[model samples]
Target: MSRERPIPSNGIVVLGASGMLGRAWRELLEELGINSRFLGRDECDITDAASIRRAIDGWPIVVNCAAYTDVDGAEAFEDEATRINGEAVAVLGAACIETGARLVHYSTDYVFNGQRDWAPATAPPYRTDEPRDPVNAYGRSKAVGESLLEPLIDSGKLDALIIRTSWVYAPWGKNFVLTIAKLASERDELTVVNDQYGRPTSALGLAETTLTLLENLVEPGIWHATDGGRCAWFDFATAIAEKTESGCVVKPCGSDQFPRPAKRPAFSVLDLSETEEVIGPMSPWEDRLDQVLIQAGLANKRRLRKARK
Candidate 1:
């Protein structure tokens, strides 16, 4: 209801504009007739304060989609990761403050320890006010960014909102759905890790929710924007197989079977109580997948038929 209120054509600038989420948000902004400036890593190095300041010189809203998303790679290159993920955010926050601009940022569910469940079958959902306990380098970096920007928000130099999401996927980038779909078509059988559970958020869905929030930029805080369901990686892979492929033998395996360098949270399903309370119930994961597949032009009869075998 609040988003229905109009925003003047002050123009929104989105960083990471070439990435999956950035592209999706760009498309939606175009549809809404809200002109946006897209700054890629090369165009405006977020690591440089002056670069960030100059890029956002005239924009009123700065949506920072730029992030170091390599979870395991962060383990090996924490400094570079921190420079991009943590310190860059502070610089951008400062730029937003100087420009009198609102900063919208992306965070991860990894901020919490996997031992704690945000959503319980018989209890209320986790509030945005819950304490964070990051378990890994990447999570720690993101937590640091969240900490660095707090002062800006407090001083009223910046009106910042952080959107913490889990298991983001999109057709435009390298993600689980695209990987699974490609594997299903190429391989005869596959074994997927089944032990991990989280919400599979489509980038398009996040982009739409962000636009809705921007349309009502006055209402700002940390919000969760993800698809409205939960499933294990294997379950999600199976769903992709089912939707894109009529039938594919997607067997369940464990993280032990295909272990990686970084330790992933066993449960990363973020409760959407706060976001849904603001934006209404999000579309289901399967529905979101369908839309993405169509958008990617991967839902053709031939592709589906090849995936089925």
Candidate 2:
């Protein structure tokens, strides 16, 4: 078990507050009565060194959720992606070091090439110490970001935690679940890729786990986090359709059927042993999804009831 720490007096500064994971973290903090300051891209340009220093100057904790997430778009704009996802993070690390602020940065499974396929029934998920070989522009950019923080963490110049997660979705924002839910409602049939394998992580659960880490003052290092269990994208989509009562027929297909500019890994399931040891086992993906959907449904009902009044 990790040692406990008192919450920072200045509260946390959440960068990229408008993004999906950031919003989820904000919601979780509010529910738990933790104080935090949220800053969107418009409010704080992470790429700007002055902006980063200014935003984090007084805060004792900084949670960075900003990133260049467009996988396909990255192929065409690798430089821009590197600037935001890689270079900017280095600047943030320096700022954290100077201000004595603990930095909590989010990373992705794309840091690994995903060439090695794992059978969940037999093989353990990819460990945290696995070699990284990112396959696409997006992955390379994220890998660079991680590399920038390594030295700072190694020398103890900055107190940092780099958490890598995958296939994250929430009720809000542009995520796989929301996309599938919309298509299932409007389309009669949908073809999804089945070759890709990974855990479908919930933003809400990830947020909660992050808070747990902060409260426990877990050691600063690389950790893998996601909802428990694994499934292919096709299975994920089908489950969503079933849960939402969407009449769409989901058909599985190979990645070749719908080729994109960037290549995707066949398997990217992350091992959560290290994370679990620190914060306990995460909720299963299906259960998290069901909870989000239920909450969304109830929120909608309240909205409708209010409108009627």
Candidate 3:
């Protein structure tokens, strides 16, 4: 992000537009009747600067949802993760600068080490300016992008907006919600970790709120976006179980119960005060979850709630 105002014209180019979050952005743009063009990795390989330039040339704004998103895989494939999620961003940033386009990049909360593990009940949300101390290779890779771009932003050489979101799920694509929903449907019981705590985000709600931020001309800088409240992974999985009415007993257990290749933060909730100040409070993750479950035909229609504008 830079000091200059971040605004874009009607036409938008969404790289990695076939991903879950990308589809959300595409659907929102179509619903709003905005002109937006989407490109898959084959059409616009972000690793190549020329491809990025070609894809984003005429668009006033470039929303990049692309990244090496595998957290656990990063431990073994750190180099590949760094190349795609870390290095390619340098190319994207340069292309955006050359094309004179406003760049909107998505980041993750894993950039933090979640040192608040000792005090989950009293843990505070991580701020945008916090010193990054990632605990895993995936987080390290993402941190590489933030590190590379901050200097350019400080020098007033780039026009960009880095938005950080977490625990994303949608009606389509692979995600925790769908996995738990399907498992709950087939299994009588499930075990979820109760140690990790973070906010859940709906891809649709996130897309809409991002559009609202663009419309409101919020400051061009690092910002955090997510649902209204925070909860443990066990809580989230349990909620999905109840919503699906799969009659699955979701048992809570410590993180040690099931280890992962990636070491996730114990407290990764991002502070939303900055984002809320501009776009109003976010819709509850539960309400947003209901919308997605309904779309996936996993929730009862009676659980419907009003969607965000």
Candidate 4:
């Protein structure tokens, strides 16, 4: 268990506050009664060091939710992705170090190369201590970000928590769940990749877990967080279809059938034993999805309330 610490009341600054994860983090912090501030890209350009320093000057804690997350798009634009994901992390870590502020940064399972195809489904989750060998351009960029931020942490100039997650979705924003739900509603049938396996994490749920750590001040290092179970994209889409009251039949297909410029991990299901031990267990993806859809007015309110509670 992580020992609790006093959270400075200088007001938390959420970088990329307008993004999906950033919005969820802001909402969760408000619910927790924490003083929070959100800075959008226009307000603070992460790529610009001066902008980041100015925005983080007063905050005692910083949560970096900004990143170029277009996985496939990153392949052709690795430099741009590196500028945002890699260089920005280094800049934030340095600023946090100088300001004596703690930083919580979000990462992805793409950091791990999915070389093992026979990983168990719904088995032991990925731990923070696991080996990481990213396969694609996006993964490489994130890996570089993690590496660059390590020095500040080792020097104790900054306290950092790196969270590696997968399949994050939310009510508003361009996520797999909303995207699949909309596709299903518009089409009669959908073909989703069934071969690639991972956890379907709700941005809201991830936000809650993130708040729990911040409020408790979980040990500064790396952590793995996601919903309770794991499944393929098809299964995740199927759940979204059921929640949104869509009639589309979700057909399972291999990743090869839907090849893109970037290569996705075939088995990136993370083991969350350490994370769950420190905080309470994460809710299943289906339950979280149902609640999100209800919040979005796409699901039955009464049933959703019951399931969430």
Better of 1 and 2 by lDDT: 2
Residue 185, candidate 4: C-alpha displacement in angstroms: 1.3
| Tens digits of per-residue lDDT for model 4, 4-122 | 65468776899999999998988877886778889999999999999999999988889899999999999999999999999989988988888888898999999987766355564
TM-score of each: 0.92, 0.93, 0.94, 0.93
- Please give the range of 10 consecutive residues that has the lowest summed lDDT in model 1: 117-126
| Candidate 4 weakest lDDT stretch, 10 residues | 117-126
Candidate 4 wrongly placed segments (more than 4 Å): 1-6, 117-119, 122-124, 303-309
- Total clashes in model 2, counting residue pairs 3 or more apart in sequence or in different chains: 0
- Please write out the lDDT profile of model 3 over residues 1-309, one tens digit for every residue: 121333454678999998999999999888867889999899998888888888998898899999889999999999999988889998898888787887888889999999874577668899999989999999999999877776766777777888999999999999999999999999999999999999999999888877777767766778899998889999999999988889999999999989999999999999999988887789888888888999899987664432222
Please give the clash total of every predicted structure, in order.
Answer: 0, 0, 0, 4
Error of 1 at 4 (Å): 1.2
- RMSD after Cα superposition, model 4: 2.4
Q: Summarize candidate 1's per-residue lDDT along 1-309 as a digit string, tens digits.
A: 245856558788989888878888888788878878888889888898888988898888888999899999999988888898899999898888777888899998888776643442333334566777787899989988888887777776778998888888987788989998888878778899987777889998898887787776535567888898778889888887777753578999988999787788777778787677767898889778877887777676555445547
lDDT per residue (tens digit) for residues 79-167 in model 2: 99999999999999999999999999998898887876446345567898887799999999999999999889988888999999999
lDDT score at residue 297, model 3, on the 0-100 scale: 90
lDDT of 2: 0.87
